[model samples]
Target: MRYIASQIGRSIRIVALSLPLADARDVSQWLGCNANASFNFHPSVRPLPLSLHIQGFNISHAASRFAAMTKPIYNAVVRHAGSKPCAVFVPSRRWARLLAADLLALAAAQKRPGRFLHARPDLVQPFLKRLSDKVRNYVIPAQNRVPSY
Candidate 1:
């Protein structure tokens, strides 16, 4: 598209959307965009805006780091998401399950045990029953508070 736009000379206007990159100016130059025509907004600049919070844990052990982050993650979700839908990404399925369990425990402690869970146990019970024994052992107790995927 850049080549085509460049070949078209000044007759056509070229517009591009991209992730913020260090070489944005070079890219704009390659695309034949003048300084006035080129725009490189920061990654945090979004149409709807975004709230970001970053915390670093100095814990050296992976398990300790993960355990330490669970409470903060739960607090962030409660503060930012409120009743809105939110998603949390983890490096692995193991961490995902562990974080989920920890988050549930946190909610339970606050007397909002089912705050982040789906209310449809009828739909979830059969699915839970089909899980492997190892999974069932961890999931059964929280069946009523199963996180909604």
Candidate 2:
């Protein structure tokens, strides 16, 4: 949230701040305000609210998480927890589809195993392969040259 003086006249003041993670190139556009004293407006830009950018997840998302351990939080909650867990890591289908039965089952131990909200497996169509094998192979191999977009 650093400020910089853009032009000469301070009379028609409209400040614009973009997300920190936003590419530095886009800063000008984000802060690019209509600096006419007659037509006054707030510092924030259109579409994105000031509260969302200034006091939101955008700050964290842009930060460099260099060489830091990530999975440990999720692992700590269920895996490394020193108790025999009763449930599953959401079998891929349950994780994807937001079924009420799945939600109830996931919550209560009694309702979990037998009684489900969405009982019929046939009703659910599983997600197909999104990234093809050729793309996967190109991306997976570390040594191979994957073209940067």
Highest TM-score among the candidates is held by which one?
1
Would you list the clashing residue pairs of candidate 2? Answer: 15-43, 101-117
In candidate 1, what are the lDDT values of residues 1-149, reduced to their tens digit? Answer: 76665577644677677655557889888776788889888757756544555667799999878988899999989998886666676779999977877786777678776677554555656686565555544443554545535
Q: Alpha-carbon error at 1 in model 1, in Å?
A: 26
Residue 5 error, candidate 1, Å: 30
Candidate 2 lDDT (Cα, whole model)?
0.32
In candidate 1 the C-alpha lDDT for residue 95 amounts to 97
Task: List the pairs of residues colliding in candidate 1.
Answer: none
* Regions of model 1 farther than 4 Å from truth: 1-50, 130-149
TM-score on alpha carbons, each prediction: 0.52, 0.18
- In candidate 2, what are the lDDT values of residues 1-149, reduced to their tens digit? 22444344343445444333334434444555333322323436535342211111223432222112123222333343323332223335634232323233333333223222133332221211344443333222333333433
